[model samples]
Target chain A: MNQRDPLKRVLYIDLSRKSFWIDDRVDLFERWLGGIGVAVQLFKEEAPKNIEPLSPENPVIFSIGPLTSLYPLASKTVALFKSPLTGNLGESHAGGRSAIAIRLAGYGAIIIKGASQLPLYLVIKEGEVEFRDGSALWGISNANTVGRILREAAIGRGIRTIMRIGKAGEKLVSYAAVITETYRHFGRLGLGAVLGSKKVKGIIIYGKHSIPIQDKKKYREIYDRLYRLAVGSDAMKRYHDLGTAINILPLNYIGALPTRNLNSSRFEGAEEICGENIAEKKLARRVACAHCPIACIHIASIREPYPDEPYFYKTTFISYDHELLYSLGSMLGVKKIDDVLRLIDTVEAMGLDAISTGVCLAWATEAYKRGIITINETLVELDWGNIDNYIQVIKYIVEQPNDFYGMLARGTREASKHYGGQEFALNFGGNEMPGYHTGYGAIIGYSIGSRHSHLDCAGYRVDQTIKEPPSPEEFVELLIKEEEWRQILNSLTICLFARSIYNVENIIEALKPLGYNYTEEELKKTGEEIYFEKQKLKLKLGFKPEELKIPSRVFETPTPHGLLKREYIEEALQHYIKLIEYKTLQ
Target chain B: MYVSSHEVKRLAILDAERCVGCQLCMFACSRRFGDGGLAKSAILVRSVGGIERGLTVIVCRACLDPPCARVCPTDALKLRKHGGVFLDQTKCIGCRNCVEACDIGAVFWDYETNKPIICVHCGYCSQFCHYKVLGVEKTI
Candidate 1:
């Protein structure tokens, strides 16, 4: 890393003390690169082991990378903290103006430590940090309203990012998310709860600093080439065209949709709520993260009439993608596109992780059907595809009106512990299951994954290619290889959608003009090191591979590769454990 | 070296609706001067209130009679045949008269140099705009 590069700066804010300081972390940046690599290192250094994830001791570290703002598609910001949801390593990536804002703000990472006694929001500008009273904004129900208020209240309109939590965060729902730029989020695991626990309502980052390049001509040449590839490539066309929601119909057809708590793998009404239908009917606009040419963020315009006024109507724009379409639509058996959008809107408003919320609701609805839970506990009928009841339940989850809703707020794993629905509760590593039932790869991948996210390593994609499942050793190797490479991509903080464009060669080429000269071999080694560092943290934080639960519902429901065998997943998981242990020992 | 006003080409927002708010044009503009980052970029694309509302591309509109040039007390900002102002760095007193004068907020400042960074109507940024939101048009 260049000594003069602002990316070498780390901003440490002690919320409890109301103090801020800048540390030149060239050693950390040069060694780990940036984003997840640097973030894991920061988390390990700052966060103590086995501490309560919601405690003020848990540090929330947000880090970007060298490629941010300088290159297209290097637009994601990685947030790392101890997850209140999983009680393990919590890591989430979000794209918007976050990476650009933080980078331009002249910091590679921001470590927010300690807890505030009173509610507050942080305004981080070019060289200053302001701790503002967030008492008025604290209990604001709608996340969008908070954004609106802050947008008006704060400066830096064009080059800024506003990351806030809603009622879910305020109430400390385990799956609560930190919404950034309204549409994007640090949306998985319990980053919001961590922020909520700290009494930090929101954070606004704005900066306008120029990055000096080592070789301007080389930088432009590489940039133009990448830009051409990004725009001209067919790999990114699907994302720009209909976005990830395009996976809905295809996944549904292959019987991997995981509908109604995995009671069935396929949704009959998948066509109605698929990407094509939504794009045709409701797609109001497409937006992009800063520096990304592929505007994959699809916002749907939902216009509805007010019940009180027959003539008056209001239009709402809600962002939707495949995960949302699956988790809120198919998982809940929501056939109507509007209902799915409405459910998504409700989830966003409350600032809950849509996947966890949907999966939790699916479990609750099943438990209700089985007479395990009743209307007395639910206060409303938990029915599949019932948007109104789901909406009410979503609110209750955040509000925690009862013991049942409180358990639901913790996520399905905890909800089922008392409710007698353990077998069907779709959670892996205590985090709610992502929308994939492809095969063993998906199950075992989630089981052993650092964050237990499908994005950790796309096991679902492996399921798509195989005629016969690979040996446990082979499968683990495949997963580990992809995941290791992904560490490099995540460190660059490039949008995973542009994975094809930023291959190893391109990544090396891209970093060259930025002053970091890395060989392919060194890059690969860095990836492995980053992955192992995260694994070590997860282990220290008390993640056990042998104890990972493979929901019985995954086996019961037929996947694209037919019914997945429990034995195969266990073998694969064991192989993964052995491999990771061997690597960690080294 | 004065060119005919009719032959002068200026960067234009061909279709503002096509902008996805990627701000690649902004980066491209900054990169044209041999650096990376938004500090040097004269073009600014921002959401119209919130992103859900859509985006507004703010750049030099190349007004027929530019307000930015007219307000330059130091005569640092010279009107180009293309209609946009050309900043003479040596002459710029760093007064920021042009920055406040532009109603559309097109004149951007380079804090490091303490001078105004204005677009010279170079089509470099337009080449990188995939959505066709930006282009170079002859003032004629």
Candidate 2:
């Protein structure tokens, strides 16, 4: 890394004392690269052992990479903390102005520690920081409204990013998400609740600093090559056309959609809410994160008339992808696309993780139907495709008026323990299942993944491609290989959708003009090191890979690969544990 | 009167609705200086309100009698043959009068040099705009 690089600077803020300072962390960036790599090291250094995730002692770290702002598609920011949802390693990546904002602000990473005594928001500009009073903005029901208010109040119009939470976060719902740029989010594992716990309302960051390059001619050459590949090739066409929602029809066609709490794999009404339908009838426009040419973000327009005045209509734009369609649509058996969009809009407004919220509601619906929970526990009836009742229950989950709602707010893992529907809870390693019910690989991937996310290894991809399922050892090996490689991409903080375009060769070439000289082997080794560091931290935080419980509903439903046996998944889990432990020892 | 031989070319916003707010053009504008960043770019793109409303592309409209040149107190801003203005950095006193005069907010600031960065109408940025939202036209 260059000594003159602003990426070497680390900004530290302490809310308890209302102070901030900078340190030249060249050593940390030199060893770990950046993004998740730097974030994991910082988390280990700043966080105390056995600290509660909501406590001020839990550090919130945001980090970007050297390749950011210099190259196309390398525009994601990695946020690391101890999760309020899983009580373990919390890592989420978001693409928007977040990475560019932080980088141009002239820092490789920002670390926030301690809690404020009152509601507060921080405005960070180039070489300056302001701690503003957020007393009036506190308890705002809609997250979008918070963004709107702060947009008017803050500076840095286009180049800035505003990250804020909603009522779910304010109430400490374990699955609450931190909304960024109105569309993207740190959308998993309760980073929002952690922010809420610290009494921090929001953060706005922007800058006008310029980044230097080693060789001007080489930089232009590589930049042109990447830009041409991104724009000219078909590799990113699907994302640009329909976004991730394009996966819905195909996944449903293959019987891996996870409809209605995994009672069935395929949804009968999937055609109504799939990507093609939404793009045809509902898509309002497409947008992109800063520096990304793909423009994969799809926003849908939903117009409805006022109840009293038939002629008066209001149109609302809601962002949607495959995960939302599956979770809020097929997972809950809601067939109408408008109804699904409304559910997505509701979850977005309340600042909830759409996947976890839908999974929780799905479990409750099954529990209600089975006579395990009555209407007394749920103020409204829980039924499949009941949009109005589901919306009411979503509100109750945040308000938590009753004990049942309180338990539900904690997550399905806790809610099922008390409510007696553990088999249908559909959570892996305490985090709710994503849209995939592909086979053994998806289940095993969730259980052993560092963040319990499908993106960690994308094992579902393996299930989708393979004709014959591999043995448990082979399956674990394949996942480990992919997961290790992904650490490098994430360290650069590139959007995973551009993985095909940013192969190891291209990544090595791209770093040259930025002054990072590294061989392919050295980069691979760095990736492995970052992965192990996260695993070590997870172990320190009391993660037990062997103890991960698999909900029986996954086994009951037939996947595209046929029925998944519990013993086979358990075997894969053991193999994963052994491999990881063996690597840790070395 | 003798005119400069340089072609009177200026970047134009062809279709604001087609812009996805990628800001690739802005980056391309900065890259002409042999670096990668948004600091020196003379073009700006932002969402109208939220991204849902659509985007507005801000650039030099290449006016026949540019207001920026008229408001330049230092006489640093010179009018191009047909339209637009170019900055004479040596004479500029950094008054920022030209920045305030441009109602469209096309005159971006170079914070490092503490000078106003005006578009040269190279059309380099238009080449990178895949959506055809931007184009370059030669004016007489």
Which tens-of-lDDT digit does each residue in A1-586 have in candidate 1?
A: 6677899899999999999999999999999999999999999889756788998899999999999999999999999999999999999999999999999999999999999999999999877999999999989989999999999888889799999999899999999999999999999998999999999999999999999898889998999899999999998999999999999998988889989999998899899999999999999999999899999999999989999978899999999999999999999999999999999999999999999999999999999999999998899998899999999999999999899998889999998998888999999999888888888788877887788999998998898889888898798889888899999999999999999999999999999988899999999999999999999888898888778888898889999888888888888888888988888888
Worst 10 residues of 1 chain A by lDDT: A47-56
Question: Which runs of model 2 end up more than 4 angstroms from their true locations?
Answer: B1-5
**lDDT tens digits, residues A179-283, model 2?**
999999999999999999988889999886788877889989999899999997786888999999999999998999999999999999899999999999999
Give every collision pair in model 2: none
Candidate 1 residues lying further than 4 Å off, grouped into runs, are: B1-7
DockQ, cand. 2: 0.75
Every model's DockQ, to 2 decimals?
0.87, 0.75
lDDT tens string, model 1, B39-138?
8999999999899999999988888799988988888888787477778899989998898989999988898899988978877888889999988877
lDDT per model, in order? 0.91, 0.91
- Of the candidates shown, which would achieve the greatest DockQ relative to the real structure? 1
